[model samples]
Target: MPDVLFAATLTNRATRLDAVLATMDGTMLRRGHEIYPAPFGPDAFVAAFVRLARGLLRSEAREGVHIAGAALALEAVLDAGAGKVVAMPMAADWGAFPLSERLTTASGATSGVAIVSLTDAALLGEMTLGAGRGVTNAVLLDLSRSVSAAFCYEGKLLQRPYLGAIGHIPVPGATWRCACGGHGHLETVASAQSLVRWMIGRLVEAPATEAAVMRLTGGRAEALTAPQIWQMACEGDPVAAELMGAANDALAHVILTLLLALDPERVILSGALAQCGPTWRDALARAIIQIAPPARAGELAACLALGELGPAATIKGALALARQRVISITG
Candidate 1:
């Protein structure tokens, strides 16, 4: 029998679930079964997941294949001991839910199922198969609607409790309140969601910049995405350029803070903000050089690299974790 594995990722933005089938070595055989427009509550999520898993199982059965193990990734801090989701956004009712147990019972994947944070999943994917492959010490920062980080030390993923919510780290002169009810967090300044809001607010005063952005986004300012603004900045739109400059500096500070503590050999970037063009990549390098300490500036500037897997890192990580669980069980 083939060592087939299953993986899924949950995103609160659209209450979406994406699932895939891959081999034991993390080669994806099939991709992207999106289940969306569903309720965001815990019970609803369980039902949707079971439905998705069952469908996958049935399809595999027809092909004479059996799933060996499975994994799910979500934007939440899971209890390492219990494997329950301890702290998650979007659904407050999900407090300490027995996710592994429920899914295992429903999906009948008796080998094993692993639940991991999207941050850890992405980091694992990078470390095992992408940019950070073969690196012993490194950090992967996920910059999306919110900022979350994962660390690999001596080739092991550090637990979330030890990391202590770096997204909430305070930034000077930042007044925008975060979803965590904190002010001036790194997320407030650098995250894609926050940066878009910041750009929209600035657009009211800079008509020329706003007009430029509107043209790029087809005259719909509301449709302005973080990547579009980034492209505009690359084209020399002053407002967009200024916002990206600040965002990159704040990101550099966060990276520098991590370097001071972890001293990782590489810092891999993922998510939307990491999609900036070569022009902005040069700008970010300049910002890091300008602000980073002179002695270590050159070394720090060289640590940054774009994640090779791009948006697929989390799912790839989930698949890799599933393969690991199957090995552990059968060994």
Candidate 2:
């Protein structure tokens, strides 16, 4: 029996799902947008569950499935009838894992940055499965559960766990707060939402109407349609261009800050915004050039490369995990 894992992705806004899939190893299989709920249903609630069961059964091997990100999706996969679920939940104590899982070997030429890919919900989910692979000397963070909490580790296991949450949610002053009552988080500042909020703010007093805003940025409804903003910038809109520049600059600063704290060899970025286009990439390089110190920049080469994982990093990572079951039982 080959161990196979199943993961699902419901995010189909402002991005192409295939982008995230670029990072997966050949062993994993990922499928997305296969289920559509009622138009008014909005959430992927019902269909997501259906897909989970189907994917699990579809796998030739009897690998256990693990649902990630939204609890609803997880619930749906569970309801659909998965044999086992392997979730590295933010709420779980990750310190129990073996040492190799905690230790990570950063990829690329950068000797000072970790080439990590991040998505909306489960920050470390993809890294643990994909990039982080089987490294044991590592830490998995999710601010959604607790802002002040993180899973610390020794050589290959949890050493002393404490509050060290990472990932995004809640803007400092934005009314969109987190379920934990905290306003502003790594999600708020760096997420695609950050760009969306910026575009809405630039709207010419149109009540932030979707129709009007869509017209403003070419009819996109994603929380942060950076591409639309990029287009506006390209079309010579000073305000739009400024926001685009600032957003990259801001994100670069954040990365710089992370470099000081964590000594990863390379920082691999996996998101729609990271690959808006050549112009967006250029602007990001410029921003990093200006804000980051020359020495730090030289001493460390943390690149902002686009992740091949597409939009299904989480799911592929999960399914890849399921495949592990096949090897375990057979080997």
Candidate 3:
């Protein structure tokens, strides 16, 4: 029998679950790996978890299951009879353990649950095996539909009650409304959602003429996405290029703040927007360098770079958390 690890990420857009079988020595088994979507909401999340766990748990020895997700979603999983679960919130103020305990008591489960944060998990993965490897001081910026950051110093992740909440920070001169009811947040101007929204607005006001973006989206504004906009920018579409440049400028403001505050050795970008590749990176770098004070421009220019783990970074971080828990239990 082999020890199996189940890890999941529940966010605003979707939930992702991964199961990996590993030997006692921490070597991953070549087979029995799975990935699938678990939609948002308590019922949907729990159902997805139970369905996956039943199929994966069959005839295999269980090591432990660790779930990284939004606070509410983790509570739903614990309520779904995920015995002896551990909950890691994506942010510090995200409450998970109290809700887990209430659900556990109601369900009469004696098993205890522990709580941490997804930022902690991501930092662990980066420091040990990903982009932050061998770096003593660095920052990992997870830029997606939302942005979050984690800090590492002296080769250890700083376990602060609160970490990066860059998404909600207001961007100067930005007019877009954030989902959090704030105006001009960095997320409002730079997130994938914001990019799509800005693109659609541009399309709407484009002189009543069909643009390349309209053609790319097949004349359906609702179907436009951030990746498509990046593709258009890459293909030299002027509107797309302009939109992307604006987004990069908005992102630069946030990065500039982080650099001035932390001055880490490196700032690694990860998530969907970061996947836009060198075009996006270069644009952002140019903006950062331009806006940085002349004295710091040379140094800041060298600090910004893309993450090495690609799309699997967060899930890999979850796996890292599971491995740590397994080791702590059996050490």
Candidate 4:
């Protein structure tokens, strides 16, 4: 019997899950845990989830189950009829994610809180950890790639009583059509996948100083991988340097927007790509300084720091949700 069950699904990709869990030593969900993977679709998924929940109920993890990913996974948790469900945007639309279930989700808005940015095109999602942590204010920001997520914690709960979103940003001519049917969304520019796509596109273009290098490389850019881009950046490739500068600039614009809107007291940055090297960190720092107002910059210094959780931040966040679900059920 596991002490807790995190209904975290693996992406269709081959990356491992236990490797992600192995990183969280301080959190309540470091070891003695179980991760269940389910295929697509909610109806069958829920049946499978109930089976897992039953197993957990008969085991140590019966006390709680934390869920993260698409809304389909969350729906399965709801069907499991567990005492509680913690739906973090572990993926795109974990809590009614994909926004495809607008009607059903709209009715059950209270069943879960959708961490949103009320402002135009803001990135990131957050959790509320109020009295549970005993800290007057606790905030976590997800910088894990494209989306920048945030959480406002007071002790073990959320500060905002209403289901209102905190991060609001507006950008005109965003020119990207979102799955949600809106133009100029933060997801267009800030997602991990989006970042990679943007890098590839930029590499292909190889603007200005890069054109000669692009031609001289004899199509090395076409053969480039994500890791290779970072490696080249580490070795100081001019083209990679330009691409990093552009990516950081776009991200900085989003961060500046977040600061202008939410002004969270403390923020922790996480995201596998965003926090990897000093180059990326320096890029974020420099971009913030360039656009951030001097007064606001000082205020955000103590409160602003990049994510440290690596790729597992989302999973640990899911475990936090699992613990919350367990407590809610018992209470």
Candidate 5:
């Protein structure tokens, strides 16, 4: 039987599960996938995983199952009786010992459990198969509801707990508040959700710009999303353009901070915001170069790039982690 690789990624907005059937030689066969809105808590997350896993199983023989998620999701899978599990933490906050203990208690389980960080997985995937391919040093920034970054050096990922919470760091002069009760966080200005909120606020202040975004969202300001804002900006709406520029400036600040601190050879942008395309890229690049130290401006300008894996990046990274586990076992 071909090796079956199951991977799941949970962000604040959604959860995605994907399975690929591959031969021992690493050739992919059938692939199946599913997505759901993110659950509320640990119990809800566990229930969702069980339901998704059951539907995916479809009477296939039990092999190893690889899961990538936050702490609760991994615990849920272990409690649900998946055999020979490999759990990867999608965020730095999750615990490994508790999940490992749960896996150890499962009956008839001969396979061992391994805990890996999703940061490592993402770096590995990028270096091996995605945009950062052949690069020695780089950073992958996931720009979703919350921002997280992974560092890669000498083709290996360096997992750091502080890196996962970089988005929570306060940005100077930011007026919005974060969910964590912090003011001026990068997430308050740079995240897709924050951008949506900022756009809504802009509509309230500038009633004239309301027509375009209201038309885009079908007459509801609350329904306006970051992509819609970008669309409006593309269409030359002054309000949308200003909001996009401000958001991009905030993001550029974050990127500039990372570049100066890490000095990586490449910086890869990923997640929903990155999907806004070249308009967003151009704005971010412009901001980076405008503020970059003149001596290193040319070098920094060449370092920014988009993630090649797109929305599938985290899942692909999880799959790569699973593949590595299989290799280590069979080698």
Candidate 6:
């Protein structure tokens, strides 16, 4: 019988939880979204997970469609051994919580509950069904409001020493303070927020580009956004281009570090920044090649690619993780 599982994404930034019910082979049975309570915490998170899963199951209208596993792709680092949330940036209330255990108990999930970082889940999703398909070793970098990474080697996800939390990797010239209270980290300039911040700070230095950007953003620096900056860079705005070039260089440094450390077959870029269109993507690819060691530059050039799953990548990754949890238990 095909394995029925429930998977969801619960990020610190969003109020609503997005979930799906599907089989092991990727047949979607039902999907739903649930809002977190006024004060979201561990209990509320567990309740929301159960509520969403049960709601999806009820919508199936099929008696005896037992869910064999459940998983959550969370925007937090979990303890590799105990499945406890060890660190959740910007979500302190959930820190040091045994989320997987609580979720399993509250939801009565049979196989066991898997709580994985959103980055790791995305890596699994891409490897299983997206751009990383057929690749045994890969690194997935999620460059959205923040930057995080995950690594897979020889078809297994590495969970020790928390390799996925690469946001704080120090770049050579990035002295901007990161949200983690650190300076010069990769997230300081490689993330969407960082890119916008960098562009805004440099707007005054480039008068022509500044005027154009003011016109583009209605003369409000506070209202500036990353996509607008990327669009301007694509259109040859000097300031935006320079800001983007810095970001590209920072990302290249991180990617090169991962390539050297993990020796992965591919490096997949995902999240909002990856959607900045082909020009930005190609430029980033070129930046990576330029910084990579000469002999491996050609090989690494072909390895960098955009994730194919888009917004659904994390959800697909959750399901893939849930399947693994189930198999481990059943076998």
Q: lDDT of model 4 at residue 112?
A: 37
Please give the CA lDDT of all the candidate structures: 0.81, 0.40, 0.60, 0.41, 0.62, 0.83
User: How much does candidate 2 score in TM-score?
Assistant: 0.52
The segments of candidate 2 whose C-alpha lies over 4 angstroms from its true place after superposition are 1-189, 205-224, 299-302, 324-331
On a 0 to 100 scale, what is the lDDT of residue 113 in model 6?
A: 85
User: Top TM-score: which candidate number?
Assistant: 1
Candidate order (lDDT): 6, 1, 5, 3, 4, 2
Question: Taking the tens digit of each residue's C-alpha lDDT, what string does model 2 give over 29-65?
Answer: 4444443332212223333344443544454344543
- Would you give me the overall lDDT of model 4? 0.41
**Weakest 10 consecutive residues of candidate 6 by summed lDDT:** 34-43
In terms of TM-score, how similar is model 1 to the real structure? 0.92
lDDT for residue 40 in candidate 3, whole number 0-100? 40
Better of 1 and 5 by TM-score: 1
Ranking 5 against 6 by lDDT, winner: 6
Q: Of models 4 and 6, which has the larger TM-score?
A: 6
Please provide, for model 4 over 242-313, each residue's C-alpha lDDT reduced to its tens digit, 9 standing for 90 to 100. 555555666677666656665555545545455455555665777777778887665654454544444444
Q: List the residue pairs that clash in candidate 3.
A: none
TM-score of 5: 0.77
Candidate 4 regions with alpha-carbon error over 4 angstroms: 1-39, 54-148, 153-184, 202-238, 325-331
- Candidate 3's displacement at residue 126, Å, is 3.6
> Which digits, one per residue and each the tens of the lDDT, describe model 5 over residues 29-127?
445555655433333444454455445545455565422221112211122122212322343323232543343233111233333344445555676
> Which segments of model 6 are wrong by more than 4 Å?
1-3, 12-14, 37-39, 204-207, 214-225
Error of 4 at 213 (Å): 12
Where's the lowest-lDDT run of ten residues in candidate 5? Answer: 68-77
All candidates: TM-score:
0.92, 0.52, 0.73, 0.56, 0.77, 0.91
